[model samples]
Target: MKIIQKHELNSLKRSVDQGTEEQREAVKKIIHDVKQRGDAAVQSYTKQFDRVDLEELRVSEDEMDAAYESIDGEFIEILQEAEQNIRRFHERQRTNSWFEPAADGSILGQKITAIDAAGIYVPGGTAAYPSSVFMNVIPAQVAGVERIVMTTPPGKDGNVPEGVLVAAKLLGVHEVYKVGGAQAIAALAYGTESLQPVDKITGPGNVFVALAKREVFGDVDIDMIAGPSEIAVLADDSAKANEVAADLLSQAEHDARSSSVLVTTSRELAEKVEEQIETQLKDLPRYEIARASIDDYGAIIICEEMDEAIAVINEIAAEHLEIMTKDPFGDMAKVKHAGAIFLGPYSSEPVGDYFAGPNHVLPTSGTARFSSPLSVDDFTKKSSIISYSEQALKSNGGKISQFARLEGLEAHARAIETRKERWK
Candidate 1:
């Protein structure tokens, strides 16, 4: 990891929205083929990208039962517990339709309704994260989404991972499909013969998946174009170097492009954490990926003071931010941007990632400055409700018509004028 002062931080910028032409072209072709060919195109892409020739697109009830039996009893219990926590957190985020009435019997309100269906894409290559399945599905379920369809890449054996299947089944998601990548996205957006279209798509995938979501965004609502996972640790002299290093490596091991940064006021602590990262890297199973991530994207920034460190963090707007200062919560008040904030030494990033009842699907690549974590709100739509009583129209219709005329919308003005004439 490169060690630098605050002035050098400008050189370490990463772009979340930028994608190669090749990626965009490839995703475009896949989307077009799926839109035209439907299920056949989805099957072909599944075979090509996943190296699995799947005859059946959806997971059957018998397969789901077998998946439950395959996993250990203890792991199932943990998933259930996590599910409860996640459900409780998201239930609080549920919205209800509300109205405000005036003395003139005019009603102004908002109607909140869940989308008809939601498509959640779970990445099945390299690793199987049942945690992700829970995180993505539970929020949609809480929002009262009617139908939740899940798509994941199948293995060479043409079987979804037992853990993923188990998670979906446990969460009441029965529409599991053996397809992934851009094809799954296209299928969800355009609707294949077997799979009905969904109102929105969520979950993370490779570059192709990201680009596919970007292409299909207007046709269907999408959560966000997530980039590589990233974590930034802000520590002081009181922070433990080993714990800080471990937390940084946790994100680095995610991908070679993943970023892990440490900003601290104490130079000694920074050097120690650097050494600790090197020592820990030797034992990591994904050492090659982690090493590359650290070498290319990782950094240890030395800030002169805590305020300087906080300034650097706000500028980065990392997806995950951990404060290991003496008063982590006290320091958090100064933090203006971060997808998720982990406080103190015990609140590691993984806690929120897995079982701490918060959505792990966070904004990446500095998008935390504006975007938010995936929540129940992502699965629902809000419509403004307006009703004008005869008395209210008589009082306000001329003003409304005048405003519409100012905009040169004659039809809008006439509509209000017609309502006013009824009152007369």
Candidate 2:
């Protein structure tokens, strides 16, 4: 880890990807081909990209059952508990369709309604992410979405990960398809012979997937274009160097581009954590990836005071922040930006990633400054409701007409004025 003074904070901020013209053109071609040939194009791309030939796109109930059976009992038990926690947490986010009526019989309100269906694209080239299934599906289910469709690339052997299937089975999300990359996003946005289109899509994938989401956005809603994982730890002299180093590595091991940062008031603690990061990297299964990430992206900033440390933290606006100070809550009160904050040493970042109820699909890069995490709200839409009685309209019609006319929308003014005929 490169230890630097707080003046070098500019090096920490990275720009969001706009994707290359070649990638954009490639995605456009893929989407257009999927639209023209439907299932045939999807299958062809699946064979070309995933290296698997799929006679069928949808996963059957028997296959899901077999996947459930394949997993051991203890892991299933853990998944069940995590699902319950997630469901319980998200159910609290469920809002009702509310209308407030005035004495004049005018009602103004908001109507909250879930979309008809959602598409979840889980990346399948590397490791199986059962957590993605849990984090994405449970929120949509809680939002009262009628149907949920999932798509992932099939392995060379023509099988999705057993753990992923098991998680979907537990949640009753049976409408899964064997597709990946831009084509899968295209299929979800526009219907095929076997797969129906969804109103919204959520989940993370590769750069091609992110570009595909950007390409298909107007046709269907998408979750954020997630960057690589990152974690920033704010610690005092009291925090254990080894534990903080381990927490940072948890995110670094995810991708070679992942960044792990530490901002601290103690120079001694910073040097100790630097040593611990190197020592622990030797043991990680994905050591090369972690090593590259730590060397290229990771850093530690030495701040003389707590206020300076907090300032650096807000500037970074990390995806995950762990406050390991003696007064974690006190220090956290000053934090203006962070996708998710893990307080105390015991509340590590992974606890929120897999087991805890909060959604793991969070805004990455510096997006936490203005954006939010995946939640029930992302799965639902709201419609404004307005009903004005005769008396109410008579009171406000003139002002409304004038306001419309002020905008130079004469048609709008006339439309509002035409209702006056009944009063005359």
lDDT of each: 0.93, 0.92
Candidate 2 Cα errors over 4 Å, as ranges: none
| Clash list (residue pairs), candidate 1 | none
* Candidate 2 local lDDT, 155-218, one digit each (tens): 9999999999999999999999989999999999998999989999899998888999988999
Model 1, span 89-152: residue lDDT tens: 9999988999999999999999999999999999988999898899999999999899999999
Question: Clashing pairs in model 2?
Answer: none
Compared with the true structure, model 2 gives a TM-score of 0.98
> Candidate 1 at 182: error in angstroms?
0.6
